[model samples]
Target: MRPAHLALAVLVAAVWGVNFTVIEIGLDRFPPLLFSALRFLAAAVPAVFLVGRPKVAWRWILAVGLVLGVAKFGLLFVGMDAGMPAGLSSLVLQIQAVFTALFAAAALGERPSRLGVTGMAVALAGIAVAAVDEGTTGPLTAFALVVAAAACWGASNVLTRRAAPPDALNFMVWVSTVPVLPLLLLSLWTEGPARDLEALRALDRQGAGTILYVAWITTVFGFGAWGLLLRRHPASTVAPFSLLVPVFGMTSAALFLGEPVTPLRWCAAVLLVGGVAVTSLAPRRGAPARRVDPDPAAADRAEVTPSR
Candidate 1:
């Protein structure tokens, strides 16, 4: 990558990192499901007109939308609202790499390298350590919810790899269109109309700002930029930067949210990020040397590494 591209990559990673803190703030004003619904709605509207026709079939779009947008994000927001700290939630979600690897093996018959297996072990160890810390400092159920969200993310990663959309931005914007009604309905059914109405009545500039930030900035800008980087560079070269997310997430949380980075938390961050780095970069044994763009669907899902 050129120096400018490197800088751009770092910027995107930072945007995604800070996104956790933004979500935490958004949760203060909106119920998780409602917040998530509005985010997709805002992201899809004007951008959909701009991004062009969807490149993949509607089945792929709908599947990814349901799993990634609805299941992964829904659980994530609810987990955070339920008391999973933003920084730690960011870190733990890295476990999706392990889940992704395992899912690929089962669903796609892609065997992982020995190094990949080792990396998964290391990542799982990190999850265990983080579990210990969260169990001590926070609600275990919240932590579990985030882990479940990560599993959904992993499943979605595999689904995306299968979809292999050529244009990440277009694929993602179309995917965005699929989730709004389902999430809104889920919010109404579960979060309650009165609570949703109360949140809307209380909405202020900050509340609307939160929606725009997550929608336009994080989803639209962030995904487009990351996809551009992948198009310009090798996936291996670009993938490691994702490891930076938890770094920025924790630091930003400490600075902005006053969330403490406890000793155990620090240890978990190191182990999880390191493990994901290795899992992502390690080549799979018996994986065919296909022409690249083999899995920009993974790219479309907001991660550079198709392996995850």
Candidate 2:
């Protein structure tokens, strides 16, 4: 990667890593689904005007949107609202990588390499350890909800690969539009009309400002910059940088939310980070030496799509 691109990658990671804090702040003001709806609405409007529609089948587009946007964020918001800590949520969500690998093998006929399998095992064990830790156990159901969100993220990964939109930016823009309606409906049903209206009406300047930051900086700028990077680099080169998100998330949570981090959580973090590195960096047993092929078609179509 060029120095400039590398810097951009790091910037994206920092932005995303701190997003957990943003989400927590937003939730303090707006209900989860409503906050999500507003975020996507912000992303969709400008992107639609600037980038236009991507050349993708509608079904695939909607599917991607529902899985990535609605399922992933909705469940995450609910999980967090239900008492799951932001730092741990950040760590557990990395399970999507393992889910992506498994789904890719099942759906795309891609075989998992020995390193990939071993890394997944180590990561899962780490997750199990984390799951058993007191921090995670406090709100077991919420933690379970977050796990489900990770699974939704994994499903979204497969759909993204299957869709294979022509332009990554346009694809992101169009698919981003899909979540608005579903999230609105979810907000209505889950949060109730009265509470939703009340939340909206009662929003102070600070709360509204938080929403704007999440919508513009976190959702729009973050996704747009990430989409650009993915187009320029291989997924392997770009994706592993996401492991840093949890690191930043934990740090930010500690600093801002005053969330406690225990030794067991640290051990789990080591396993999770190590597993992600092994999964990302280790070569496949029978795979070709070249990581990035000139022909995009020859590149390994693993299930784990970039999460820009």
Candidate 3:
């Protein structure tokens, strides 16, 4: 990657890293379901008009939205709200790589290389360490929710691969539409209509800013720049940068949110991030260079490796 693209990659990673803390901040004001719903809402809207529709089937678009937007994010926000630390949430979410790999193997019969297996083993070990730590310090239910979120992310990745939309950003924008109504109804069901109205009425500057940051900065600019990078370079070249997310996430959490980075957690971060890098960059003898779709969300969702 060129210096400019490298810089852009780092910038996107930082935006996504800081996103966890931002989500936490947003949840302080908006209920988790409402907060998540508002995120997709902010992402859709008039911009949808400007971006227009993707050249994909409606079924695939809506399916991707339900899995990616609704299931993955809903579980993540709820887990974080239930006391999962922002830094830890980001780290645990990396397990999506492992889940994606496993799902691909089972669903697509793409068996892993030896190196891939080893890398997944290392990452699983790291998760076990983190889970043990969480058991002692955080709510196990929250931990479980985050794990479910990772699984949903993995499933979304597979669905996106199957859909194989022509225009990534446009598909992402249209797909953003699917979650709005479902999430709104869920917000009303879980958080209640009264609480949702109260939160909206009481929305403040920080909360509003948080919502915009997630919609524009994280989802739009972050994924937008990333998609461009993948288009400009090989998936192998660009996908490795995802390893940096947890680094920024943990460091920023410590610096801004004052979340402590314990020795064990640090060890787990090393293992998890390193394992993902290995799995992502593992040599594939005689394998073709993975074709990077125009979709940024597809790239990020399938961070383990680019599709063959």
Candidate 4:
């Protein structure tokens, strides 16, 4: 990869990492579900018109959208609002890789390599350490909610593999439209129509800015750049850059949110990030070694949601 492209990769990771704080900031103004609804609304609208529909059936798009957009993001924002620290939430959410591996084993009969299983075990143990630390550092409910989001993300990854849409960016943009109505309905139901109205009326510049950052910068630009980089280079070359996200997430959260990083928390971060790196970046044994272009859709689904 060129130095310029590498910088672009780092920039996208920074945007994604900082997004945890952005979501936290946005939630201060809009209720979680409503904020999420508006976020996707911003993501889908004009982009959908420009991108056109993906080649896959509408049902698949709807399926991926509901699971990825609504279920995963809804839980994520709600978790953050419930007191998941921005940096910690970013760290915890990477568990989706572990869950994805497990789900793929069961649902798709794609067996995990020994390295993958070991990496997941280390990652889970790290989560246990982080959870124990979080009991004092943050809300357990928040942690649990983020974990649930990771699970939903894992499920979405499986569904996406099953669907196997061509053109990931287009699929992502179009599927984004699927969640707008449902999330709005949910916002009205849980947040109450009156409160929802109040929240929208109360939206200040910060709230609006945060939503645009999430919608266009993180959701659109982050995924779009990643897909383009993958197209230009080998997955091995481009994919490893994702390891920088948690590093950026933690550092940015400390700077912006003043979230403390305890000694145990640092240890846990190392374990979790290292484990995920091993799980995602390691080569599998007994597999044919061939150079194939990474599937843009799979890459989109894998790194894309957590990048949210």
Candidate 5:
């Protein structure tokens, strides 16, 4: 990658890292589902107009949206709202990589390399440590919800690979369009019109603007830039940088939310980062060579020609 691209990647990581903080802020004012709905709505509208439609099957697009947008974010927000700490949420969400690897193996017929297996094991160990640290009293249910969110993300990865959108930008734009309505419906049904109206009416201008910022800058721009990076680089090259998210998340939470990062959690972070590195940095095995059919005319010409 060029220096410019590298810089952009760093910027994206920072944005995503701080996203937990942003979510915490937004949730203080709005319900989780409503906050998520508004975020997606903000992302989808201008994106639909500017990027237009992606050249993909409607089913695939919908699947992508349901998995990535509705399932992932919805579960994440719920988990956070249910008492999962923001710093912990950031760390736990990294489980998506493990889920993605497992899904790829199961759904795509891809075999895991030795390094991949090791990486996953290491990462899992880290998660176990984190879980222990979280303890039974600290909203185990919320943690489970985050794990569910990770599984949804993994499913989305498989769908995305299968769909193989012609362009990432178009794919993102189109898939992003799928989540708004479902999320709105969910918000209405669960949160109720009364609570929704109350929250909307009571929110100060600053809170409303924060939601808009979370939607446009964090969701749309962040994901758009991410899609662009994925299109330009190999997943192996790009995906590992996401490890920084928790690091940033922890730091941001400490600074902004007054959350503490204990020594044990720091150790867990090391194991997690190491595990992810082991899996991602390993060498890939060579694929079997493919045979090509000889041209009929060429074969005939060869038969007619004199032997050398």
Candidate 6:
């Protein structure tokens, strides 16, 4: 990677990492589901028109939007609001790499290598440790919700890989549009019309600013830059930068939100991130040793790391 591209990769990781805190900030003003709806709404509009047509089938786009946007993000924000700390939420979500491997095996008939299996075990063990740590200090239900969000992320990764759209950025923009209505309907139904209305009535500059940050900074620029990096370089070179997310997440949380990173949490971070590294990097034994497809969408099948 060129020095500039390396910096850009780090910048994207930082944006994604610190985004947890941004999400935490957003939740203070809007109900979780409603905030999520607006986040996607801001992300999709106008930009959707700019991204050109969706390169993949609508079904794939719809599947990803529902799973990644609705289920994953909806659960993540609600989990944070329910008491999952931003840093730990960031850490736990890394489990998506493990879940993606498992889902690929089941759905796409792609098997993990022996080392990949080992990495999955190590990563799950790390989650167990993190669970034990969170149980001592936070709501177990909240942690579970984030884990479930990771599963949704994994499911969506498989869909994205299968979609193999030539233009990753366009696919994501269209996917962003799919979640808006479902999330708003869900918010109205579950969060209650009164609560949603109250939140809208209460919106201020800080609230709106946070929404734009998550929507444009993290969702639009973050994913767009990431897709560009993937197009410019191999997935192996780019994927490793994602390990920095939790590091930034935990540090930023401590500095900004005053969330303490316990020693146990540190241990969990090491295990989780390290396991993810191994899982993500190890090549399957039977697959031919070859270059990743030059197309960004196809390259992402092996490794696609998106923002929080």
TM-score of 3: 0.92
Tens-digit per-residue lDDT, 46-109, candidate 1? 9999988989989999999999989999999999999999999989988998999888889877
CA lDDT scores, all candidates in order: 0.87, 0.79, 0.81, 0.82, 0.74, 0.89
Cα-based lDDT at residue 27, candidate 3? 88
Give the alpha carbon lDDT tens digit for every residue of 144-206 in model 4.
999999899888988876776556677778888988999999988888999989988988888
lDDT of 6: 0.89
Off by over 4 Å in 6: 285-297, 300-302
Please identify which of the two predictions, 1 or 4, would achieve the higher TM-score against the true structure: 1
Which sequence of candidate numbers ranks them by lDDT, best first? Answer: 6, 1, 4, 3, 2, 5
- Model 4's C-alpha root-mean-square deviation from the true structure amounts to 2.9
TM-score per candidate: 0.95, 0.90, 0.92, 0.92, 0.88, 0.96
lDDT of 6 by residue, 199-262 (tens): 9999999999999999999989988898888878888889999999999988889999999999
Misplaced by over 4 Å in model 3 are: 283-308
Indicate whether candidate 3 or candidate 5 has the larger TM-score.
3
lDDT of 2 by residue, 213-293 (tens): 766676677767766676677777777778888898889999999988899999889998878777766654432233444
**Weakest lDDT window of 10 consecutive positions for candidate 5:** 299-308
Global fold similarity of model 2 (TM-score): 0.90
lDDT of 5 by residue, 1-308 (tens): 87877888777777777888888888888889988888777767877888865677899989989988899989999899888888888888877777777776776666678888988999999888887777743878888898899888878877876765555656676776888889889999998988788888988986777676766766676666766666566665666667777888888889999987877788778887788667555643442332332432221111110000
| Best of the candidates, lDDT | 6
Of 1 and 2, the candidate ranking higher by TM-score: 1
- Pairs of colliding residues, candidate 2: none
Clashing pairs in 6: none
Which 10 consecutive residues of model 4 have the lowest summed lDDT?
A: 284-293
For candidate 3, lDDT tens digit of each residue in 220-243? 677667767766776677778887
Q: How close is candidate 1 to the true structure, as a TM-score?
A: 0.95
The clash count for each model shown is: 0, 0, 0, 0, 0, 0
